[model samples]
Target: MTRITMREAISQAMWEEMERDPDVFILGEEVGVWGGSYAVTKGFYDHFGEKRVRDTPISESTIVGAAIGSALTGLRPIAEIMTINFAFSAMDHIVNQAAKLHYMFGGQLILPLVIRTVGGGGRQLGATHSQTPDAIFAHFPGLKVVAPGTPEDAKGLLKSAIRSNDPIFFIEHATLYQTRAEVPDGDYITPIGKSKVHREGRDVTIVTYSKMLETSSKAAEQLSGMGIEAEIIDLRTLRPLDMEPVLESFRKTNRAVIVEEGWRSYGVGAEVTARIYEEAFDYVDAPIQRVAQKEVPLPYNRTLEQLALPQVEDVVQAVKEVL
Candidate 1:
């Protein structure tokens, strides 16, 4: 086992996958010469050459369209959208074409395509660039949504998404690229659509993912000082969201606090809270609470931006309210 940053883990996953499968290639803005906007594809251009690590114009639609075309021709394409906010420009192609192609063709086609993008409200990227619209994409069928919190999951999940014969939208937190964690030093892949328990506790179930996972973990530690043991469940995948672990945890604690970097209304927390009540209502000891970004466009000012985004204290308070 070795400790590495999230960026390195993601880079290693793509590197290994491209090396393992010749069909796997990457295309996006600044992926080649700029080494990716977030530097996740650093050194890929030189290593894979222009034929494989082809860079395209600053057009999200063109990038996604090209990837879909190549995937239809039996090539595994990893399309990078630079940022999640820009994904809206290619929404038609992503949701209509890439997602429904295989089914529309009666399984005669396989879109082994992965759309990689970064998102989150930090680093002062302003309102337009820093948005976590993961739930919106997950709402559509035939599109797998994955957002990892740790380096290990990031590496493994990316590998699995590349191999799956389905369209996948992989979201990476912009602020978590520098976060470090211990990862397995091997050619292994983590299955998509599985939620894993990051910390075990019997007090209250704290469910979260992506950048919010880190925030929630910190809040859990703070809650410990007050004699509160919070069990953290990372919903690594959003679309095929696994509720077994979440339900099981809620069954034990009889309480839950769903945290997300996005807004609270109709967000991930809302969906999880609904599912828990629907399946595990009998185990409810208290009303579930939600922690999420404020209902406003993220500001450019650092102070205002942090104010709008969910914080550790917000999570702690939400947990207490639920408990």
Candidate 2:
């Protein structure tokens, strides 16, 4: 095993996939020459040549539309939307067209494309840029949503997204790119729609995904001091939520505390909580708790931003309340 940062892991996944398949190509603003907005795809253009690593204008709609068009024509396209805030401009191409293409065209066409974007609030990118819009894309059918929390999962899940036949919305938290972890040496794909239990416990289940996994893990450590063993489930794929593992964990710990950086109203936690209440109602020993952002635009102030977003202590307190 080799330790690598999430940015390096993501680059390796796309590089390996591009080298493995000729059909795989990348395009987006600042991707080819600028190495992507956050430098995630740095050095890709020089290595893959200009054709494979083409750059486009600063148009999210055009980039996603071209990818969708290329996908229908049997070319595997990987496009980046710069940020989650900018993706709203391409919702028509992303939701109305690419998402419905596979089923809308019967079983003839398989739209294999990936839209990579970044979102998180640590840098205080203001209210618009810091929005976690994964919940919106996950709401639409025929689209796979993936948000890996670590280097290992980032590498593995990116490879899988590149090879998947359906359209995939790949979200990378801005603050998690530099996080280091041990990744496998050879080719490996972390199966999407599968939840991984990061910790074992008998008290409460802390179901979370993406960057929130870090906050949840820290809370778990603090909760351990209080004799509370919080089981952490990273829902790496938000679309096809892997609730089986969650249900099994719920059987071990009859309470839950769902967490997200997005708003509490109709967020990812809301969907997962509904599933728990519907499928595992009898197994639940208490009202399902949630730790999420306050229902307001993320403020520019550092202190206010941190307060709006769910913190480690917030999760710990929520778990205590559930217990």
Candidate 3:
């Protein structure tokens, strides 16, 4: 086992996949010569050469569009948009074309495209650059949404996403890139729709993904001292959601508090609450609670921005409420 940062694990996954499969290639702005905006692909340009690790113009729509076209023509392309906020410009290609191509053609074409981008707000990028838009892609039918919280999952899920036969929207938290964790040295693929129980407990169950998972885990630790045992479930994949584990956890704990960095209204937490109510309402001991970011444009001020997002205190308060 090797300890590596989430960014390094992701880079290793991409590099290994490109080496193992000739069909796998990557394209994005600053990806070739610049080595990506966050330096995730720092040495990829020299290792893979310009053809496979091609760079694109400052156009997110064109980048995604070209990847979709390449996938349709039998090439596995990992298209990286600079940020999730910029993906709005390419929603037509992602939602309309890449998502519906196989279904509209009656399963005639297999779109094995992986669209990877950074999301969430911790670096004070303001409203334009920091938005967790995974819910937007989860709302679509044919797209697979994934947000890995650990270095191992980051590496494992990227490998799976690249090999999947469907279009995948892989969202990475901008703040989690440098976070380090141990990753195994082997060929491992975490199934897309599976949820992992990060920390098991009996008093309450806290469901979250991406950066929120870390926050919730910290809250859970603090809660543990107060005699509140909280189970933290990391929903690795948003779409094709594996609700069985969630329902089962709710059944065991009889309480739930969902944590998300996105806005509260109609966010991923809302979906999880609805699903829990629909399937395990009778089993729940209390109303499902959600700890989400306040509903407003992410402020540019550092203090306000930190307050606007969900924090360990917010999660601890919500868990206390449910308990």
Candidate 4:
């Protein structure tokens, strides 16, 4: 095992996948010459050449459409959209085409495409580039949504998404790119539709993904010091969610708190809370609590933005309320 940053792990995954499968290629703006906006694809253009690591115009819709077209014809394409907020421009292709192609064709076509993008706010990127769209894609029937928190999960989940037969919307946290963790040397893949218990406890269950997972973990640590043990469950894959671990945790703890960086209304946490209530309501000893961002346009001020988003303290308070 070796320690590496999330950004390096992601790049390594792409490089290894490209080396192993000739069908796997990357396409997006600044992906080649610029080495990707976050430098995740740094040096990839030279390594893979322009044929495989091709760069395109600044058009999200066209990029997604081309990826879908190539995927239908047997080429596994990884489409980088730069940011989740920009993906709104290409919703038609991502929602209607890339997602529904297989089911629409009655399983005739295998859309093995991975849509990679950075999401969440921590760098003060303003409102335009900082929205978390995991819930949006999760709501759709045919899309596989993944939000990995740690460097290991980022690498393993990306590899799995690239190999899967369905289209995967792989959401990465912008702030976690530089976070380092130990990763396995050999090729390995973390299965989709699986949840991992990040930190186990018996007092309360905190369900979250992506950046919120880090927040929840920190909150759990703080809660531990206060005699309130909280278990953290990382929902690696949002779509086709593996609820077994969540239900199991809820059964043991009988209290729950869902943490998400997105807005509260209709967010991924809402879905999780609803699912828990429906499946394990009788087992729950208290009402499920949801910790999420404020329902207002993200402010430009750094302090205001931080206030608007869910913090570690917010998660702790929510857990206490539920307990």
Candidate 5:
């Protein structure tokens, strides 16, 4: 295993997959010439050439639509939407077409399509550009939604999504590109719908994913100083959410604090909390607490934006509340 940044891990996954399968190609705004908005596809243009790393106009609908068309013709296409906020423009193609094509067509039309986009509110991208609407996309049945927290999961999960025969909405956190972690050596692939335990503890269960995983891990360290051991469950895949790990951890800890970068109401935390209560209510020692962003449009001001988003202190406080 080698340590690498989340950006490098993601880029490496796409690079390796494209090298292995000629059918796997990428299309998006600025993906070819600009090397992608977040630089995740840096140097892909020169490496893969125009045909494979084709860049399109600044139109989310066109980009996603073209990807669906190519996927129908037996080409596995990775469609980048630049940012999650812009995904609303292509909702029809994403939710209606790409997601339901295989199922609606009686499994004859296999869409090995991956819709790659970035989310989270950091760096003051404003309310419009900065949003974590992961739960909204995950609500749909046919689409597989995945958001990885660590570099290892990012590389492995992306490889799996590219190879899967279903449509996947891969959400990357905008602020986690530079975060580094140990990733396996070549040809590694993590299953799409499995949640993993990042840290083992008996005091409390802290569940999170994407950028919030980093925040919760920091909070766990601080909680440890206070003589509290927190077990963190990273929900890498949202749609086919593997709740077994979460439920098992909760049973052992008897308490939980669900943390997310999105709003608390009707968010990931809400869903997870509901499932825990439904399945593991007997193990509940305290009312589950949720640490999430303030219900408001993220501000352009850096200070206000940070305040609106969930913080490490927030997670710590939420964990304490549960205890």
Candidate 6:
């Protein structure tokens, strides 16, 4: 085992996958010369050369379209959009084609493509650059959405996404690039649609992932000191969401609190809260509480940015309300 930052972990994951599979190649804006917007692929250009690590123009639609075509032809293409917000420009390709092609063709073809993008606030990158859309891609069927919280999870999950013969949206937290953790060496991969019990508790279950997982874990620690044990279930994958663990946790605790970094309405929290109520309503001792961002355009101001987003205190309060 070795300690590394999330940025290094991500870079290593893609590098190793490309080295392991000759068909795997990456293309995106600034991925080559600029080393990626967040430096996630800094050395990839020189190491893999321009052929494998191709850089495209600043067109999200073109990047995604090219990836779809590349995938159909047998090349495993990992398309990187600089930010999640810009993915809208490529919605046609992502939603209509890449997502529906396999089913549309009666399962005769495989679309082994991965879309990598960074999201979440805390960098003061303004509203356009730092938006959390973990739930956005989940709305569409056939797209595998995942957001990794720790450096280790990032490495493992990315490796799995690249190998899967399906279209995947791998979302990364913009603020988590520097966070460090120990990642095991050698061959390893995290399952695509499994949620882990990050911190087991008895009083309440806190469901969260990605950047919010950090906040939820901190809130769980604070709750523990107050005589309330909050179990943290990290929903690493948003779409094809695994609810078995969530139902089990709610059945044990008899209370639930969902923590998400996106908007409160129609967000990941809303979906999870509804599922818990549907499957585990009889086990609930209290109503499910949610900790999420305020409903408004995310402000660019540093103070306002923090105000609009979910905080550790918010998670603590939500947990208390549910308990």
Candidate 6 local lDDT, 154-243, one digit each (tens): 999999999999999999998899999999998799999999999998889999999999999898889889999889999999988999
C-alpha RMSD of each candidate structure in angstroms: 0.8, 0.9, 0.7, 0.8, 0.8, 0.9
Ten residues in sequence with the least summed lDDT for candidate 2:
101-110
List TM-scores for all candidates, in order.
Answer: 0.99, 0.98, 0.99, 0.99, 0.99, 0.98
Error of 1 at 77 (Å): 0.5
Could you tell me which 10 consecutive residues in candidate 6 have the lowest summed lDDT?
121-130
lDDT of 5 at 152: 97
What ranges in model 6 sit over 4 Å off? none
Higher-ranked by lDDT: 3 or 4:
3
lDDT of each: 0.94, 0.91, 0.93, 0.92, 0.94, 0.91
Cα distance off (Å), candidate 3, residue 82: 0.5
Task: Give the lDDT of residue 220 in candidate 2.
Answer: 96
lDDT of 1 by residue, 1-323 (tens): 99999999999999999999999999999999999989999999999999999889989998999999999899999999999999999999899898788888899988889999998888898889889989999998889999999999999999999999999999999889999999998899999999999999999999999999999999989999999999999999998999999999999999999999998889999999999999999999999999999999999999999999999999988888887
Q: Which stretches of candidate 3 lie over 4 Å from their true place?
A: none
Which lDDT value does model 5 have at 102?
82
> For model 3, what is the C-alpha lDDT against the true structure?
0.93
Q: After superposition, how far is residue 194 of candidate 2 from its true place, in Å?
A: 0.9
Model 1 misplacement above 4 A = none
Clashes of each: 0, 0, 0, 0, 0, 0
